[model samples]
Target: MDEITEGTSQVDCDILVIGGGTAGPMAAYRAKKKNPNAKVILLEKANVKRSGAISMGMDGLNNAVIPGHSTPEQYVKEITVANDGIVDQAAVYKYAQNCYEIIQELDGFGIRFQKDENGDFDVKKVHHIGTYVLPMPNGDTVKKALYRQLKRARLLISNRYMATRLLTGKDGRIAGAIAVNTRNAEFLVVRAKAVILCMGAAGRLGLPTSGYLFGTYENAANSGDGYAMAYHAGAGLANLECFQINPLIKDYNGPACAYVAGPFGGYTANNEGMRFIECDYWSGQMMQEFYNELQSGKGPVFLKLNHLADETIGEIETILHEVERPTRGRFQVNRNNDYRHGMIEMHISEIGFCSGHSASGVYVDDNACTTVQGLYAAGDMASVPHNYMLGAFTNGAVAGEHAIDYVNEVDFADIDEDFIAAEKERVLAPTKRDDGIPPNQVEYKTRRLVNDYLQPPKVTRKMQLAQDRFAETRAVMENEMVARNAHELMRSLEVSSILDCADMAAFASLFRTESRWGLYHNRADFPERDNENWFCHSILSKDDAGQMTIKKKDVDPYIIPIEDEEKDAYDKQRIKAQA
Candidate 1:
């Protein structure tokens, strides 16, 4: 480990795993285990013990394919339909095939899962057509389990260091990355043979409805760092227009836990206490229905659990309160609303890019390799549609193990000192200024523009205006944004990432030209799905001339074929009225 100082410092490692969240730890652990002699460093902007999306832990596996309950083929087809057939089935299939082993490994790490009396893994139905949800009653301690594995594997962990940019070699392969200490603003250059990015999602791209900046559905720290880094590194990002929008608690902005509660006789209902959608699975179609309900006279949807028996409600509360967003229980109590007597109010979440819940992320193949050489992306940041936490683990392991093979065949690329110097100057510029626009103001305005112009039910003119406004916001961030200290500097840097994502979101949404993923890319002018003109994956990247470009990449042919009859499964989420 290199000593920390006021000046720039450098460290060399065989592999550098960015983001200590769900995927990054698994990636680093697998890399180190593959070759005990290799020096693998897991870099996190926050402490490994409590960081990323699952910092407090998750409630359950959103897409678990345990043997008896579900098969990899079934899971692949389900995700394919859910994503509107614009999926890389191969990538989804790979995650499903390997996820069972990853679960067993996590179980070995002392993470507990809900199992039946026969010692069989307890699986429940949450999706529209499959049984995939596997609960973790004691899931709040998940991060602790991962921390233990990382230490036992002897992988070096670096906390409080946020990477700003990727360092590409002369040959355009990944050379290293440049990061800054969030505490002291110290610039540190990490040179590595390979790099794996698992930096969650562009969660903070949209401002919460509550007017709180940090109150987002995804972790607040996941401010599109990986998305920005990959774009600058010249990697193609897939389906940026297919944004992540969830049905969350109103004002509180936490998950309503439909997966956990739906299996226990809880459901999403209108004010009339009538169920609207047939399934609780989160898809764009489902969100479209949710948005419609909010717009209809039957407005203000609720997660209704008041009809269930006392014991069932108690079990639901125990799981929902103890894991995932534990603060959810407290929030309900603050409102004086109990599940036994009343329903939890729900609303549509603000839009952001996330492959974990939706299908917008850095493009990667089945093996987790990105378009750039020696660079791999997994977790929510990577483009495996609807790949929840278990997908993060499986893909992280794949990236880590594959990177080892690549590192063995190559030598360390030369680091350009001039590039590092330039980045250091750019990163530290805000601190040098005595007074200017605060980062919070710029971020607030940028995200406000995101909601105003880029939020779905998208209009072309508004999206065009979004580009103009974001450019202005970027100018403010670059020229006038000021930071009083290192912490403020970190926030300032995050503003840049958020702006990049906001730009990509607008650009990709306009390029698609059709309303494909329901509300995710719903163009008001082009209000219908057009498979004839736009049926491929929309790829967004930074072109050679240093400009953002959009192009179409053909979706991979499905290995587990989907019949025409099954392709419209998700489109039928709204329940039909009986005579």
Candidate 2:
């Protein structure tokens, strides 16, 4: 092997938006629109033109807060109920209020939303209440539309750089970030007045049952970078115990897309083709029911689309195959299964953290401001429950707009030399080692352990055991993991982040004693929702000693109060069998 050459580069920007996926681009674009003269940089690990969660593009807005469809208050109530009442209503409401504007703005940018014959928005109900699901039959071009708008905004674009750690100033505020060029192995020291973390979810933390690392429900690139970065930088992440386990196309590992199919009369069913759940909304409660049915000797579950008319089936195929994950059609064809004749097999995805579908992410307020000064987060990585695509856009807008105002108030601070040197050594260590455990192997092992121990109906001893395995994985990170090249180096760094998320997941799960959020945090040992004691957010952060610390923070008072009778609206989602 040739001698590995190391290089360094520095950049100065007024605002830095990390992860160009659904949120980062919006953040960067909005920041530039807010202050065109202010230097803004949109940094992405992959091509900004196609990256993050919506890299292939999304099928529709899972949470579109449009007029005549849903009110922000009703949306808030639905999300709160969906998430089992452990949510920051303020943050959720903010997204609900502003998401419509972002949708209109995207529409103006040439992104299409399904409209009725009467010219009003064609919206559908996927949530237990309210019609929030807005389909985009041509939604595959969403990233392209955003890319066009991003170019129009003219923000500086840095692609193929994986952000490893956040840099803090002497004042303990976010000064910048440390990143490496994934292709060339060039180290980067980026100095920005404000940094918005929109690195999507920790999708790669767990191995897909297919044993394909990249075959995750979320984009393969989201390896918990934002969650780990924020935690190491002392940002509090909430409800990590509330893991992201979606009902996906078995083995293919993507959404069976209840939101898209349910409106067209497609529903999740057991082998008997009977609807078990009243609603197809992807919630913890809904998942709990799905899991129960699958485990209840009705072993294999499926998306029942065969019952639909030929025209409807054709429409579903057009939306499912053309938009979002286009690979699903090929997967079905390869398996010799057609939606018109057979039920699409469904399975529970391996555990991960995603605020898009379930509530587990870096805790942020309504303004998209994280607890850490000068650091902000949004999208699936930030804790705004069930924000989905539209939430990502609205929160990205919030982060970008607020960051501009923040940058105006703050000045560039000096980066700590010791910290920089330490981070550099940490990131470059894998490259220096000749051979040891490969990054893919380490990631796979850690994720396999996650499935073995942390998939819920959580047992106390099992989670404790998961912690022990995670500690072993941490040991592997320190002593065994190796990278042969820059791309491998990026994977190696991601393994460390995944380990951090795994440890946090186990720790947070153990801390929250009572079962809640349906299958998301269902503790087998304590099978009850203990609102009197455990109703607040379970926040995890690194302490002074660099140890993971768990604390209970009160859920902010609700702006829109739920009636006592309505609190259990999502509890009995299962449709009982007729005697």
Candidate 3:
């Protein structure tokens, strides 16, 4: 590794994996495994032991794609229908094909998945068309499992270093990345042959209705850093308007774990205590039905586990309280609520970009390769529909293996000193200001605007106004936002990322005139879905003049073609029994 001197801190590696969350550690592990001699470095904003989306751990695999349980073709088609047919089938197909492999690998790593009496993987039907949700009874230690593997791989791990930007070489390929220590405020320059980003999602882009900034469905730290870095590096981000809005525990702002509890006879119910949607699987159509039920005369939705047996409810509590958010039980107890006696109130989550649940992230091919050479993305940050946790692991392996091959073909590129100096100046500017806007205040205002204008049933005028307000907010972030310490500096940088995502969301929403993805990208003005011109993926990138540009990219021809009947399967998510 050729180290380039940039002040006091200089680090070099054969491959650099940013965001040591669900996908990142796996990527680092696989990169080292693929090329044992090459040095692989993993960077994280927090401890690798527990961070990102699965910080608490996953409830279950939303898309297992297990062999006997489901096929890649079937899994691909289900995701295609779920996303309103605007997905790159190849990308989803790749995830489907390889995810099962990772599930078994995780099993070897000591992460347990629930199995049947016959010793078969217990897969449940949650989607409109497939049985993919695999419960993890002891999944709270998923991060621990990954951490063990990362340690065994003997890779370098840097914790509390938040990567802010991707450094490009003279040839315009990924050379390395720039980051800062959230603990000490020391700037870091990582020079590498290849870089992989697994920065989770833009979870903090929208303020939760609870009025708490940290109370988001996704990990609070995932404030669109990957999206911002990828965009600035000139990578294409797909379906920014197809935001991630989950049916979460109201006010508490965490998953209600319908995917885990649904099979145990738990269902989403309206105030009348009747099931509204047929499937609990999260999709745009499912959320639309959820939103409509809340708006309907029988308002306020609830996760109805009151009908379950005491034994079943006990089992549910064990899984819910122990895994995933873990705070669901505490939050419920504070309200004096129990699943056996009362239903848990549910609400639609704040809008943000997360390809793990929704189809909005940096575009990547089957191998996790982005448009920019030597730059790859996986996990919630990569554009693969309904990928969930298993997808992140599988895609991480793909990116890591491919990145090793990529680095072998290309030699290390020199880092430009001027570019490094400019980025350093920009990052440190917030701390330099004696008195300026606090990052939290700026974030709150920007996210409030996100909810006011960009949260869907979007309107042309509202989105237009959103653009104007976003521009002003971006200016505030660029000029006025202040950071007193390294932690505040992290927040300040995250605010910038959130602003970038806000701009992308507003511009992308306005660009796609037709409303699609059900409640996700619903335009009140254009209430109808226009497949004629809008069927293709809405790709966004920074133009030459540094303005956000949107263009329609043809969806890669489907490997597993969707039947006409199957296309509308997601559109009819509401149960006829409710009607």
Question: Best candidate per lDDT, number?
Answer: 1
Q: Rate the local accuracy (lDDT) of all candidates.
A: 0.92, 0.90, 0.89
- The collision pairs in model 2 are none
Clashing residue pairs, candidate 1? none
Query: Whose lDDT is higher: candidate 1's or candidate 3's?
Result: 1
TM-score of 1: 0.99
Give the per-residue lDDT of model 1 (tens digit) for 459-527: 999999999988888888889999888888899999999999999999999999889888888889999
lDDT of 3 by residue, 357-443 (tens): 889889999999998999999999999877888888999999999999989898888799898889998988888888989999999
Error of model 3, residue 168, in angstroms: 0.8
RMSD in angstroms between candidate 3 and the native structure over all alpha carbons: 2.7
- Per-candidate TM-score against the hidden true structure: 0.99, 0.98, 0.97
Off by over 4 Å in 3: 1-7, 577-579
Off by over 4 Å in 2: 1-4
Q: Looking at model 2, which ten-residue stretch has the lowest summed lDDT?
A: 1-10
